[model samples]
Structures are given as structure tokens and as C-alpha cells.
Target: MAKAYRSVIEASMAQNDSTIDSTIDSTVDSTIDSTIDSTVDSTIDSRHDSTIDYAIDTTIDSTIDPIIDSTIDSTVNSTIDSTVDSTIDPTVDSRVDSIIDSTIDSTIESTTERRYS
Candidate 1:
């Protein structure tokens, strides 16, 4: 009787140990797999976002910078031309005409004085 009871108890203990080991192994495997998958997915997503942002920034700079520069240059040139035409040209013309009239009057007066005297 004593021998049979000992054998039965030993068998039960062995079965319980095997069950516990199997459970632990299954839980550990699932946890490790999920953790690795989550880490890889997060890394990939971050890199992809960075790549997209860089490409967009590069494209915008390449496409829009030249157009902005051209517009600024054209506007500046047009403003300068307008200013010269509206202000400086007329002032210069007026001065030139006055000088010419004064010179002509002086020349005529000098000639008349010489002829009469």
C-alpha cells in the first residue's frame, strides 16, 4: 500500500511539472515574438516618415526657390526702369534745354554787339 501511494504521488508531480514547463514555454515564445514585431514595425514607420518629409522638403526647395528669385529680380528691374523714366529723364531733359537756350542767347548778343560797335 505504501509503495503504490508513493508511486502515484511521484507520477502526479511529474505530470504537473511538465504542464508548468509547457505553459511557461508557450507564454515566453508569444511574448518575445510580439515584442520583436512591435519594435521592428515602429522603427520602419519612423524611417519611412523621415524619408517622406525629406523628399517633400527637397522638392519644394528645388521647385520654388528659382521661381521666387526670378519674380523678385523682375519686380526690382521694373521698378528701377519706371523710376528712371518718370523722374530722372525729365529732369535731365529740362536742364539740357535750359543750357542750350542760354548758350544761344549769349552767342546772338555777342555777335550783335560786335557788329554794331
Candidate 2:
């Protein structure tokens, strides 16, 4: 009877050891699966961030290009206006300047003739 009881107990112990080993294997598999999932999630997140950054950069460039062009145009226009007098007509100025020069020359000629006489 004692020998039979000992054999039964030994058999139960072997069965328990097998169950523990199976549980340990399952736990290891679960850990590996979790690690793989986390890696996938990290890759996806990085890709998403890169896409978002690219989109933002494109948006900023789109917004800045027009602003820069407009600023450049305004600056060029302002510089031109400041450098040259746009209000005065060139034709009128040339006529007045020519008349003044002719009057001065005539006055000088008449004064010289009178002094010599």
C-alpha cells in the first residue's frame, strides 16, 4: 500500500511539473508578443510624427512664400517712390529748365554788349 501511494504521488508531481513548464512557456510567448506589439506601435508613432512634421513644413512654406513675395514687392515699390520724384512731370521740368537757361544767357549777352559800348 505504501509503495502504491508513493508511486501515485510521484506521478502527480511529474504532471504538475509539466503544467508549470507549459505555463512558463505561455508566459514567455506572451512577453515576446507584447514586445513585438510595442515595437510596431513605436514605429507607427514615429512615422506619424514625421508625416505631421512634413505637412507642417509644407504649410509654413506655402504661407511664407506669398508673404515674402508681397513684402519684396512692397519694399521695391517703396524704394522706387522714395528714390525718384514721381509727382513731378519730366516734360514740364525740362521745359522750365531750358527757358531759365536761355533767359540767363540772353541777360549775360546784353550786359556784355552794353558794357563794351
Candidate 3:
């Protein structure tokens, strides 16, 4: 009777150990699955955020760059053309007209003198 009781107790302990081991394995598997799911979700969220940021930056740059370039071009062209017209065009015209008038007068005088002589 003592030996039978000892055997039964030993069998019960072995069954308990197996049950504990199975519970531990299930818990570990569940923890690993939850960790993987969280990691995947975080990675997807990060990628989506990064993509959105990049798109916004690209759109802003594209929209603003042309306006800036056009503004710079208009300013530089207006400044240079205005400066040249104001400073150089009138002086050149005045000098050219003076020379032409002088030459015409001289030619007319020579022609009149030859005709009179």
C-alpha cells in the first residue's frame, strides 16, 4: 500500500509538470506573436509617415521653385533693361544725330561753293 501510494504521487507530479510546460510554451508563443504584430504595425506606420512627409516636401518645392525663378528673372531683366535705357540709349542717339547733322551741313556748303564758283 505504501508503494502504490508513492507511485500514484509520482504519476501526479509528472502530469503536473507536463501541464506547466504546455502552459509556458503557449504563453511564450502568444508573446512572440504579439511582439511580431506590433513590430509590423509600427514599421508600416513609420513608412507611411515618411512617405507623406516626402510628398509634402516635394509638392512645396515644386510649387515654390518656379515662382521664385520667375520672380528673379523678371527682376534682373527689368533692372538691367531699365539701367541700359536710362544711361546709354539717349547719349548714343544724341551723338549720332549731331554727327549726321554736321556732315549734312558741310556737304551742302561744299556743293554751294562749287556751284557758285
Candidate 4:
């Protein structure tokens, strides 16, 4: 049981580390994309400052920024919720159940031994 618990812990840690790395890479990529989009918009605006260009810039900002923000927010929230549900909660519940089962079995065996002896 102890061995099993230790294995679960190690596996959970490895999974969490992998998740963190992936999340970081995803965030960095998203940030870079947003930055590049903004830079391009700025360059276009500088070259041709017109009402239509202004509207396009406004549309891009309104559309792109929120989409990026929403995507990031959803990603972070889902990651957190999944980590708690899939990893932390299950690990804790497993350990607790194991300990309880061990204790109960030990107690029952000892009681039966005393009666038989």
C-alpha cells in the first residue's frame, strides 16, 4: 500500500510538471502572436492613416484581444480545475481510502486473533 501511494505521488508530480511546461509554452506562443498582430497594425496605421484603416484597427483590437484573452482565461481555468479534479482530489482520496482500509483490516484481524487465542 505504501509503495502504491508513493507511486501515485510520483506519477502525479510528473504529470503536473509536464502540464506546467505545456501551459508555459502555450502562453508564450499566444503572447507572441498577439504582439506580432499589434505591431503589424501599428505599422499599417503609420503608413496609411485613414478612417477605414482606423475602423479596421478598431475591429482587430476588439475582436483579436478578447479572443486571445478568452482563450487564455479558459485555458488557465480548465487547467486549474482539471488539476484539482484529476490529480489532487483523486490522490488524496486514494491515500485516505487506503489508510482506512488498512486500519480496519488490522483491527478486524487483531480482534479475531484475540478471540481465537
Candidate 5:
């Protein structure tokens, strides 16, 4: 009877040890897998976001900047040309006409005075 009792107790202890070891191994494996997956996913997401941001910024700089600059330059040049044409050309032309008229009138008056004298 004593030997039979000892054998049963030993078998039970062995079985309990096996269950404990299996549980610990399963829990540790699950924890490790979760941690690694989370880290990898976060790292990949961060890198992808950064890459996309860089691509957008680069595209804007390369594609849109020149177009905007050219439009602004064209507008400013056109405005300046229009202002000069509208404001200065007529003023200059009027002044030139007045000078020419005055010169011609003076010459005619001088000629008449000489003829009368």
C-alpha cells in the first residue's frame, strides 16, 4: 500500500510540473510575439508616413513652385507694361506735340515779321 501511494503522488507531481511548464512557455511565446509585432508595425507605419510626406512636399516643390513663380512674374511684368503704356506714352506724346507746335508757330511769326519789314 505505501509503495502504491508513493507512485501515484509522483505521477501527479510530474503531470503538474508539465502543465506549469507548458503554460509558462505558451504565455512567454505569446508575449514575445505580440511585442515584436507591435514594434514592427509601428516602425513600418512611421516610416511610410514620413516617406509619403516627403513625396508630397517634393512634388509640390518641383511641380507647383515653378508654375506659381512664372505666373507671378508674368502678372507683374504685364501690369508694369500696361501701366507704362497707359500712363507715360500719352504724356510724352502730348509734350512732344506741344513743343513742335510752339517751334512751328515761332518760325512762322518770324518769317512774317521779316516779310512785312
Candidate 6:
């Protein structure tokens, strides 16, 4: 049982690490995209100052939205995969795992509080 639990925990950890890496990569990608987007927005804003057509704003948003949606989908898939790997184990009792998780959480929190106090 201990070995089984450890294996599950290891798989959970691997999934968690992958999730973290995905998040970091997504964040970096978003940051770069955002920076480029802001630059483009600024240029558009400047251009709009001359033309004054609000419809162009809608067009720009429509063009950019798909890219953003795809990024979101990728991030969501990583999250879902990690969640599936961790909490969706068939051999484990989810209720028992939840209890174990809560117990560990509480114990750690209590220990931290005692240390600070």
C-alpha cells in the first residue's frame, strides 16, 4: 500500500511539475504576446486618432481573439491533464484521499502557525 501510495504520489508530482512548467511557459508566452499586443494597440490607437472609425477596433479584436482563445485552450488542457492524472486515480478512494489531504494540510498549517507563534 505504501509503495502504491508512493507511486501515485510520484505520478501526481510528475503531473504537477508538468503543469507548473506549462504554466510558466504559458505565462512567458502571454507576457511576450501582451507586450507585442500593447505595442500594436498603441500603434492602432495612434492610427485611429487620424481616422476615428470605431469599427476598426472591433476588427482588431476579432483578429486577436482566436490566438488568445487557442492559448487559453492549451493552458486549460495542461491543467485538465494534470487534474486527471492526480485526482482521477481509480484504485484510490477519493474520499479517503481528500481526508488525507486535508489532514496533511491542517497538520502543516498548524506546525507553521506554532513555529511563527
Using lDDT as the measure, which candidate wins?
5
Residue 110 lDDT (model 6):
100
Report lDDT (Cα) of residue 13, candidate 4: 96
Give the higher-lDDT candidate: 4 or 6.
Answer: 4
For model 1, which pairs clash? none
Q: Cα lDDT of model 1 overall?
A: 0.94
TM per candidate comes to 0.54, 0.47, 0.56, 0.35, 0.58, 0.31
| Model 2 stretches astray by more than 4 angstroms | 1-26, 86-117
For residue 9, give model 1's deviation from the true position in Å. Answer: 12
lDDT of each: 0.94, 0.90, 0.94, 0.94, 0.96, 0.88
Cα lDDT over the full model 3 = 0.94
* Clashes in predicted model 3: 0
- Put down candidate 2 lDDT per residue, 29-104, tens digits, no spaces: 9998899789988899999999999999998789987899999999999888765665455666888999999999
In angstroms, how far off is 103's CA in candidate 4?
0.5
Q: Best by TM-score, which number?
A: 5
lDDT by residue (tens digit), candidate 3, 1-117: 999999999999999999999999999999998987899878989999999999998987899888898999999999999988998888998999999999999999999999999
**Worst window of 10 by summed lDDT in candidate 4:** 43-52
Residue-pair clashes per prediction, in order, are 0, 0, 0, 0, 0, 0
lDDT of 1 by residue, 15-75 (tens): 9999999999999999998987899878989999999999998988998888888999999
**Weakest ten-residue segment in model 5 by summed lDDT:** 33-42
lDDT of 3 at 40: 84
Angstrom error at residue 65, model 1: 1.5
| Candidate 6 residue-wise lDDT, 1-117, digit = tens | 999999999999999999999999999999999997889888988888857666766776788777888899999999998887887764367778888999999999999999999
Model 5 earns a TM-score of 0.58
- Candidate number with the higher TM-score (4 or 5): 5
